[model samples]
Target chain A: MHEALRFQPVDAEPVDRADVVAKSRHLRRVTEGAARGLSLTIRGLRKAFGDNEVLRGIDLHIPAGQFVAIVGRSGCGKSTLLRLIAGLDAPTAGGIAFGEQPRAQDVRVMFQEPRLLPWARVLSNVEVGLGRERSSADAQARAERALVEVGLGDKRGEWPSVLSGGQKQRVALARALVSQPRVLAFDEPLGALDALTRISMQQLLERVWRDQGFTAILVTHDVAEAVALADRVLVIEDGRIAEDVTIDLPRPRRRGSAELAALEGEILKHLLEGSEDTSGL
Target chain B: MSLIDSLPRVGAPKLPKVDGLIPWIVPLAIVLVWQLACVTGFVPSRVLPAPTDVALAGWKLLLSGELVRNIWVSFWRASIGFVIGGGIGFAFGLANGLSQLSAKLTDTTLQMVRNIPHLALIPLVILWFGIDESAKLFLVALGVFFPIYLNTLHGIRTVDPQLIEMGRIYGMTDGELFRRVIFPGALPSIFVGLRFALGIMWLTLIVAETIAASSGLGYMAMQAREFMLIDVVVLSILIYALLGKLADSASRALERLTLSWHPAFQKK
Candidate 1:
């Protein structure tokens, strides 16, 4: 229909809720109630460590069930932004409003490090994600289901010490997923993984995002990753959003496809320009 | 990717079960040489009793019920003092480690007190508790307290902050955090403290019992010394060695049990 083409914006900033509202409508018609996400609206969000202001003011609106990637040079406050969104750290100024004040289990974070408890078995580690319902008797069943989702059900009884780097991160993903969170914030979750594992993990992440419909915000340094997985990619420069690019391409995006490569190149070019300007070179 | 690659690999070479007895050879040899030296008159029994003479003394004391009674008394005192000291030390460690305010209030005083050698307080302890069982108990308790306190505090403080943050993110209460993460993480260090405290516990008890009047392995040794019962004295020394080794083995067993999750404690 002409309506579908006319209503949806490709990508632009400042990213407005109108884009999200329209996109979600179009998405609901396409996927039909698949998303179980909470919309996040951040306004004038600022964070400072002592006098060094990291995030001057970040304004963002993530639509329910959208995948948003934040890419930046180191020290550009991408991780800090994820922390603020996840409620792990308070913003110095401005405010962030989730559509609802999410329940404790409704917001989960997967850190770059697996952070799985070495003392706890894989299944118990997943159960930890259940919060207050950890003792609810059916908690084990739910945790097992989550592990199976991550292809780690057979590893439930194994100690975390024995798991490989990729396996450990998978267990961490299971832990994050077990709670069925509405908004999942990832702080460079795949940064430590090898290239092959990173690709597969990306596929797994995409699959889960599609299946669960959680609003996922991934903070990373990889431009290709940003373009590959994100519906909208926000390039952070100088503590603010430099670009808000929407990848309108279809699902199961080919890794080496020209369209994906072009988007990746465009973002990388922008990042380099900003860096060059910063260094006055 | 093939099924053969996934098949189980052969493990390390198996040791014959008799390999367990390898360590016993030296002890047996030393005892044989000791008994032979006494038998050949190369060592005088009056000065250093033969192994058989010491065993005979042990048998006689066992018959008189004196040996069992003394050992039981020493064992009881050690257990009571260990429980009291270890309990208090563990309580203080938990408080100071978990709370900034508690550490601020007590840690400095504790550090200052820790520098004073606990055994040096014997004269003052005698003046205070008067050579009764209480005095010896106080010495043993004081001696046992510091190691547990230091180790427990260190253990709690050194639990991975990342895991603690993860626990908080997952919605663990303070009690749940301590129970599931902090305490278990701290246990290996606490075991280190336990082993150290056991050594000091025996050391303090020996000094206290020897210096005081009645009823323990040390007291028995002292009485035998007065009567020139060299064999009895030798038996006492051997008992102390046996007791120290026993305590160390017991703690190692406990550590193996509780810390099976640790990489170092995991069976090869």
Candidate 2:
């Protein structure tokens, strides 16, 4: 916070930029080394729909509390991987194991469509994320806390139909977070939002992840989003993890900064080449 | 919240209470023209009674308590028939909607029976049940069945699968999934079926009463026609119209009450 105030007057001060970056790392590291998130291990993760193999023999481990972004072209099985990780779909061949025997609410997925109940009030929708504990006394309080975390406290009584697209997604996020899942998977949750709203949503996602210390797996088509929010960006090509790049950047990364743009460009190059390699031949 | 506040909400303008009189104009004008024609000798009372004559007949029937008695009988028949038919239809609909085996076993046969008009079975129903209360019940129940069944099935089938999926992911059990996701999602279409059935309910009741009944508006109207009492017949017809309107209004009130969350039902 002090870093933002100090950098307020210096329009493009290079020293201010470095200091901001350094200060933001302090913001990020607050949750970086916490053991609050569960570690995920996948082995020979294979999925096929009929004869179509969407994912083939994927093996990877995500350490506890790391934010990972999966990026690829459409139909690249990035979402498929995330779904398998979140246990939304059963993997045909392999198994996924958390570091421990996680509870039912240990993992939650925020779908692209928000998937809110149109009949339910915003607070009730969030309370749904409490799973079987929904009937408990503190459920409403917990749901309210989650809503306030997403900056939607006033929307508690509003119907989901009345909300804007971005607000609905925020409600969905609050629902996902209400359960305090050790692993949160997002399936392009912000893809439907306007560009400016998408950026703000991305920041909200980052803030919640930092505050809660939960491992986040975001699958998206935008390479820039992958670099901007994730500690590690995994590139899936031809149903495989083609490249895994560790983004050692600081928190609160600027949208159009040199470091982020270069990483995004490099990932985009790999993605474009992967497209040509399959279709060109 | 600021963003939502800044966004323009979709709301229709509030309707003033005086606008309620707008719908009465055409009906009132028709009555005025009919009364004028009757008074001027343009139309004979033998063919059609004037509106005032019908009102006078209605007042006489009300003082004798026959109007209320017949209305009560008809209303009772409609209610009982609707409950029986709607209950059975809802059961079949829910079964078929949720279970593939149930749908496969009975849906084709039900569809075949549905294709045969229930009113056309009136003679057959009379033969089978001897023009008794059961015959009336059979006809009215049969008439009210299809709309509720078809719409209930459709509503259940069309519930957004994505919402169901989300419910499953959030650790909803089978019962929870149905109650929280499937049932509420199917409610709007179920209400549509209910309204349609209410219309059929009144139509079938009138026909059943006209066929053979000791009491009811239809019976009174038919009996008055036989005696050449034009005013009494017209009064019965008017009463039937009012009863139909009342049933329709009741169903609409229910839709508004339950479907308050629905955008189409909400008023500014």
Candidate 3:
């Protein structure tokens, strides 16, 4: 009966933050030493919408399999940077080249809205990620497997409209992961979900990223969420990477730990300080 | 602290179920009243026949096979006209929906013509094709065309732009995009057009057959009126109602089958 309540922990006990942090640091160090997932290198990427320049020249490098979160005030070009990387839009000036040349099927983006086709069932929506290359039978099999991975196996036949907000996002995640894309770009996909649902989604995302080893770039406005899920949190100001703060904490880290709170504070400090200069603009 | 919890809970009002015999009661009562009036001579039988008389006339026509033959003839004409008009409408809609160049070239002209009632074109059509089947076919087809064309165009235009962007990002080809996204999105509206076109089909057929027809339900009613056979005329009217109801039910069934994904169509 206790296990039926998804929000509650299976074993109710107070965890020692210091001990968990030490263990996670050790685990992360061991994993970091090994060959990681796909790496992305961006050199002076610029995007301008006519006279309004969204992203000025920017440069960054992300190690493969590493989860990086970009946080900024609205209209800071974080989303634009993501769109450029996803190949949804072209870069106006500087070039963005992957470590390995990625195909059209190699990158997927999950928008704030689930963007599920209303006419399609949840399983068929996932099958869309497979594109036109696979047979209907193969696509169906893969889609079912993906749905199971997202804990939506029973809901495969349901229309997307019937699903909850969190469920819709889960189906979107399944759709993105079905193709086994090397890079997954999230454009504040959990912004519309309730607080509890958002936390669960963040955990789900962390677990999926760990299992799949896909390079993930999350563009979010939540500073705590960025500190919680990302290996490194990037603070963007005026379309530029103002601060790159590495989170040395390990997996399954305590949410409200002093160490995590301190890191969040540090990132917030930099963000506030950066915003002061560009606030009027 | 808990405002919602503090509020009184009011149960929803229970609606009376009219799914059984309740709906039939009113029509049956109306028929009873009519039959009583006819029997009592409250209404002249010459102007409006008794319900029993109309039923007997229908049975006679059915046994003689005249009713069946005329219904078949009208059905064929309607089917042919619908196919021709609906087919052209669908093609034009697709062309205008997909290509801005085509829309710009033809939409204005089409809209202008659409404003002119097809019924008003009857004199011109009669002059061109005479009082033959061609005149009736042309009228029925013209009447069916506008609704289908307009709704199809509106459906294509109003499809969510965000879904199209998602499709493009996912590397869907133009044909695949149309099949997976645009077409499904537009289908509900297309069905709306089809239902409307069907109603127009019947209306046009009735008018055309009445104006100039040698054989059909319309012609049979006209022949009955000439002989003052009010019962036959009443039977013909009933037959038209039956046909219209059947056509509507068939279209609704198709809608249910195709648009099962739509929330509005889902069973409670």
Q: 1 or 2: which has the higher lDDT?
A: 1
Task: Compose the digit string of candidate 1's lDDT tens values, residues A42-148.
Answer: 99999999999999999999999999999988889999999999999999999999998889899999999999988888899999999989999899988987776
Once fitted onto the true fold, the runs of candidate 1 whose alpha carbons sit more than 4 angstroms away are A1-33, A274-281, B1-13
Error of 1 at B36 (Å): 3.8
lDDT of 1 by residue, B1-268 (tens): 4696577657745576968888889988999999999999999888898999999999999999999999999999998999888889999999999999999999999999999999999999999988899998888888899999999999999999999999999889999999999999999999999999999999999999999848999999999999999999999989988999999999999988878777887755
**Please, what are the lDDT tens digits per residue for candidate 2 over residues B208-239?**
89987878899999999899998998998888
In model 2, which regions exceed 4 Å deviation?
Answer: A1-33, A274-281, B1-15
Preferred candidate (lDDT higher): 2 or 3 = 2
Model 2 earns a TM-score of 0.91
Docking quality of model 1: it rates as medium
Q: Could you estimate the TM-score for every candidate?
A: 0.90, 0.91, 0.88
Each candidate's fnat, in order? 0.78, 0.75, 0.81
Candidates' C-alpha lDDT = 0.88, 0.87, 0.85
Better model by DockQ, 1 or 3?
Answer: 3
Q: CAPRI verdict on model 3?
A: medium
Q: Give the TM-score, chain B only, in order for the candidates.
A: 0.93, 0.92, 0.91
Lowest-lDDT window of 10 residues in candidate 1 chain A?
A4-13
lDDT, candidate 3, A1-35, per-residue tens? 11122222212434444334424543553455334
Query: What's the lDDT for residue B260 in model 2?
Result: 78
Candidate 2 lDDT, tens digit per residue, A1-281? 32443223212234444444434644664655376699989999999999999999899999998999999888889989998998878999999989988898989999899999988899999999999899999999889878866767768998888888999999999999999889999999999999988987887798778767889999998889999999999999879999999999977788999999999999888888835654321
lDDT of residue A124 for candidate 2: 96
